[model samples]
Each structure stands twice: as C-alpha cells, then as structure tokens.
Target chain A: MRLSENRPSPRVRAGRELPLSGKDLLGLLSEVLAKGVRIRFRASGYSMSPFIRDGDVITVRPCKKTDLRKGAVAAYVRPMNGHLAVHRIVGGTEAGFALKGDHEPIADYPVAASGIIGVVDRVERNGRRVRLGIGPEKGLVAALSARGLITWAFRAFGRNKGSVT
Target chain B: MTDRTGLDRIFKPSEEIVAREIEGELIIVPLTAGIGDIEDELFTFNASGRAIWKGLDGRKPLKAIIGELAAQFEGDPEEIEEDVLGLVEELVKRRIVVEVV
Candidate 1:
C-alpha cells in the first residue's frame, strides 16, 4: 500500500485538525516574545497571500517601536477585533502606524506603536529560508507590493468570482 | 524519613515555557526549540490543569501544590497526589515543567 493513497483530502484533513484562531496564536506569540524568545508560527489566512501564502512558516523577532517603518512587515494587533495581523507598514499617523496586507484592498485599523509586537525577519517556504528586507524574493515581493499589484489581483479574482468580501 | 515518590520532589515552571491567560484560560507554549514551529506546539490547560500550573512558581513544593489543589477540588488526598504527579510527570517529559532541587 502506498502512503500517498492513505493521505486525507483537504476538507477531511481540515476537519480532523484542531483550529487555532489568529487571536489565540497571537496571544501565545506575545507571551513568548515577552520572555525574550524568537518564535515561528504558521500563517493561516489569505489576507497576506501571494507574498505570504497560507501555511507558510514565518520567523519573527521581538522588535522595538523605533524599529518599525514604512514598507516593513510587522505583526500587530488589530484593535477592532483584537486579532493578530501580519501586514505591511504603509504609512504612519500621529497616534500610531498604518498597516495593510499586501493583497488587502483597504488598510486595517491603525495600531498604536505599542501594539506592534514583532517584525518578520524571515519566511520559510518549501523548506527554504527567504530572508526578508534584502534578497531577490524580497525585491520581487516588495516591488509587487509597492505597486499594489497583489491587491489588484485579489480584487480581480473576487470580482470574477462575484464573491467580493 | 521522606515519603519518596510521595510528593517530596519540588518542581518549577521551566523558563523555556511561555504562558498566557486568555479569556480566563491558561495557554502554554514551550520555547524549547527557538524559532521552531510554535503554533503546532501550543498546550492549553483545563481548570484543574490551570490550578496545577499556577502553583509551579519555583517556590512551592509539589506537596504544597497538591494540598492546595486537593482543597479546591473534591477528591481523596492520595488520588489527588496521584493525578497531580501524573500530570507533572507528563509536563516534565514535554519540557514544560522541570524538577528543581
């Protein structure tokens, strides 16, 4: 018997696996960071897709408020829902910083500088470490993100499917 | 004479374990392997587990913890000791808790 034949389908696998919400993972991440530890967690949503696909592993390190800047990817708590969001820092406000997913249409609710927990330093995809901020993958993704092509693509897909949310 | 395997050992919460209280539940994440996949490693504690976890503050003996838990919960002292010891042993194996001198 082949092992591949025994593998469960996506729907069945999803059902068998326990679901961990973004808020739950973020709560643990925050505590680990507070203990001065670097943590890695799997990404689970399509908000930051293409650049960060679902199931991709992300390595994040504790960061200071001064370490954040526009164009950087930071993990922050969305005030509206208290859920964690890993999004790009597009701009800043007097109160805090503005964030948006690379493929999101609109910016999320502004997160105060204090609410920002860690900055993503590396992303693991297909067992390879793609360092953020400097590299070919970074350059390509940053370019795509800068021009908002990913967001445009997402919107187009939603429009075509008539499932725009 | 010490009871030996009868709650003489003192254990403390491992520094490698990071815990959070969310919505009145205790969630523990063991940071033994730095930068490893952590979402897959989270362990949430139940009401009884939470009681045992909170008492492992590096200063309390296992016997003291058992006494407190036994008072809060309804059970025989020997049975409570057995359950607490079993849970602690499991946590020790997972590196979430450590036995201290």
Candidate 2:
C-alpha cells in the first residue's frame, strides 16, 4: 500500500472551519494568547444569545488580572470539567469573579483569576460588528443579570423569543 | 529518479505563527495580521504533514527531509519527494514558511 494514500490531505486555506473539541480549543486558545496575539473564532452556542448568537464571530484579547472587572465578557476555563466558556462577569466572589450567561438564570461557579483566559473584545454577526453586550451598558447588563432581572426584563419587553429565559 | 535540483534549499517557519498539536493533529494559527484570525482562515496538518512540519527547523535542506521521511516510511522516494515539495510550496505561498536564502 502507498503511504499517505488514505491520509487526509493537509489544508492551509481560508474559509475552512475546524470542529475543535472543548479541550482542543482551550489548548489552542492558551497557546495563541500566550504569544500576546488576539484570537478570533466563531461562537458556537446560544448561551449568550441576542448579544452573541450562534455562528457569530468573537475576538478575544489577552487580559491581565486587573482587567477582570464586572460586566466584562470573558473566556475562562471551567474548573469542573476543564471546558472553556465565554460569559459575562456578573459579580465578584471571595474566590474570584462570578460569571453567568445572559440567557441563563444562575451564575456559574466562581472562577479564579488564573482560570480566566482572555476577555472578549469584539463580536461580529453577518459580517457586521456587534456592540450590544460589550459596550458601556455592560455594567447595567451585568447587574441585572446577577439579580436575574435581565430575563424578566426581556420577557416583559417581549424580546424573550428565541432566548433562554 | 526525481529531479532533486533544488533539494538543497532551506526553509524555516515564520515568526508570526503559533502551532499546537492536539489529538494527534497539528493546528497552525497565523498572526500575519498581528492577530490570531482563525475565524475564516485556519490551517491543519495530519500525521504525514506533521512529520514534515517538524523537520523544517531552518537548517535541514529539502532533500535531507525527504530522505529521512523515505527511510522511516515504506514508500517510493519520488512520491515522498513530491509530497514534501508540494507541502512546502503551499507553506511558502501562505508565508507560513520562508526560504532561508
């Protein structure tokens, strides 16, 4: 049999999307960010929906510990399973910062500063830039999300369709 | 016999790229734009490609790499040379690897 006959051809082209597992993604993120370079990838879930919808592209920049402020959307590694998540910083806890998905009801377990990877700097949808949850109003959004009022407000305003409440 | 005229050319990986191997695959993230923009552009190499990539240390010539790979795998020397040259061409075109001359 010929060697490499069955092996997949090497690809180094544009417009190709690699389906990376959570672990693989975390490894890639850590490696790229450590080089002081920003990374951009398509968001995969609706957990931060309406603001960051599925298929939206997000740019994450290397962040220092002092940058972990309330209302900032951060990419972090979950301690429970070592999976990576991008959520909003809802509040501060004794251990670290509290993170929560805007569409979710409760905040995730506190993530230590070291567990935090980077901060989301930009979001794009349909080739256009999105500045909804990453703007100056982020503080207000975080406060409401922490109190579990953002969903109620969305429901009250009839913007709850297609969003987890 | 394969045409080995340019086999002595040396090439090295660019400084604007970061690579990592996960699950037996090599993932290359390019920083050509000073940012890791993999949203639309991403590069991945399989086992064969990974073997070739590891040999590009800015010191080894193309012929040496092809010889090493030929000795390790059961394949025709000419075909192995073709594969290596083909990959190097693509890498050079994308600025991932640059000729050391």
Candidate 3:
C-alpha cells in the first residue's frame, strides 16, 4: 500500500508570494453581488478546517470600513502587497476588530478594520452550499467553526507538542 | 515611539510604490523597507490622517504640511502638528518610509 500524504501541507500566513494587484482586488470583490459588491480569492491549508478547508474557494467582497461586525470572518489585503489572510474576529471596538486563528489561543492583531474586504457569507463545497452559521461546529462549515478549540485541544493532547505551531 | 529622522516628509509616489484602495480609503506603501513581514496587518486612518497623507508631495516640509492642512481642516496647527507628526512617526516605525532628505 502507498503511504498517506502529510497533513497541514501548505501553511501560508497570507497568500502565495505573488503581488496582489488592483485587478486582483477587483477579481476578489466580484464574487459577491452574484450583482454588486464583489471580491477575488484563492485557497490553501486546513488552518480553518471543517469551516474553510484546503482547496475551498474563498469569496472576497470589497467591504466598507463600516460593514464589518465582531466575530465575523474577514480577509485582509495589505497596502504594500496583494496577499490575503482569513481569520475570525474575537474583539473589536467601533474602530476595528482583533484577529486570531480559531485553533490558536493567542490573539494575532487588529486588522485596519476599515480595509476588510468582506465577511465570509457562505462556503461552497463541490457545488453545494453547506448552510452554516458563522461559529457552529456541525454544519460542515460550522463544525470547524468551533475554531481554536480543536487546535487548542490538539495542543493540550501533545500528540505533536509545541511542534503544532 | 515612531522614528522622526527616517521619514523624508516629502514622499513621492512612483509606479513601484502605490496607494492601496479599499473600502473607500487609500493606504500608501511608505518608502521604507521590509514592511510586509507582519501578515494580517491592517492600518486605518480617520479623516485628518487621510488629509495629512494626501499632503505628502515630496516637497513640503513637515511643518508646512500641517499649515496647508490646518487651512482646510478645523484644528489648530499646533494641535494638528502633534497628530501629523505622530502619524508619520508610526508609519516610519513600521518601516513604511524613510525620512527624506
């Protein structure tokens, strides 16, 4: 029998090193609006798992600074480059929200809050919409939505130890 | 504290460096170095910060930048100066730009 492939294959912090461009930005925003607010996207890794998986297509919408809400999943595109990141919001003020991987215990940072493109509206799997609420850990999308809990559990297990990071 | 001497105060945008347009706002890649290391980084500005950034034309002195700004906006130059300097300072601290000569 052939050996199985390793898990967590591509752990990218943002996106491929490719420069994100205006066209790319437009491409990302276009996914919304099936009509108007649009966005562009790409996918990799299982960091968000069960909710967003490896090979899952992420839809990005160019969001107004005002559109973001606490606990919403958001994509952040920086000024100097076009790479992107998707994370959950735990804390935020009227200004912006703080971000972190659901599986990780530590808070990463607060994104500009204003530059947020769009919150993840839904996830598509093999042409099917999995009908998921943002944080549930059952509806395929929501199952993994439990987030940092599983990663934290995995860490507590020490099956891999500090190596998990 | 953000660096004072690093920013040229007169930043000129070129093809390589550009403003990031998102959510009806613009963010410029300051002429600093390796500012892209921190992933998921997002910086925002209030209305006044936006005005100060637009004033950066690579010719105006930091002081003058505030004066030109005070005329259109409501704050006193002395007060706005602090905010202006602070914004530029933080931008510099992030390695977004070097103080121009």
| TM-score of every candidate | 0.67, 0.82, 0.38
Using DockQ as the measure, which candidate wins?
2
Q: What lDDT score is found at residue A64 in candidate 3? A: 59
For model 3, the docking class works out as incorrect
Report the C-alpha displacement of residue A136, candidate 2, in angstroms: 0.8
Report the CAPRI category for model 1: incorrect
Better of 1 and 3 by TM-score: 1
lDDT of 3 by residue, A107-152 (tens): 5555675555566656666656644436453333222333446555
Candidate 2: where are CA atoms >4 Å away? A1-10, A13-17, A158-162, B1-6, B46-48, B72-83, B99-101
Native contacts recovered, each model: 0.24, 0.60, 0.03
Which of 1 and 3 is the better model by DockQ?
1
Q: Residue B92 error for model 2, in Å?
A: 2.4
lDDT of 3 by residue, B34-75 (tens): 122111333445556666666666677687777776676664
- The residue ranges of model 3 lying beyond 4 angstroms of the native Cα positions read A1-36, A62-67, A78-82, A93-95, A133-147, A151-165, B1-101
**A1-165 in candidate 2: lDDT tens per residue?**
344674424676442356577777788788888888899988888788767988899999999987799999999998778899999999887888899998777888989999998999999989999998899989998898888777676778787464752
Per-candidate local distance difference test: 0.69, 0.83, 0.50
TM-score of chain B of each: 0.85, 0.87, 0.67
Ranking by lDDT: 2, 1, 3
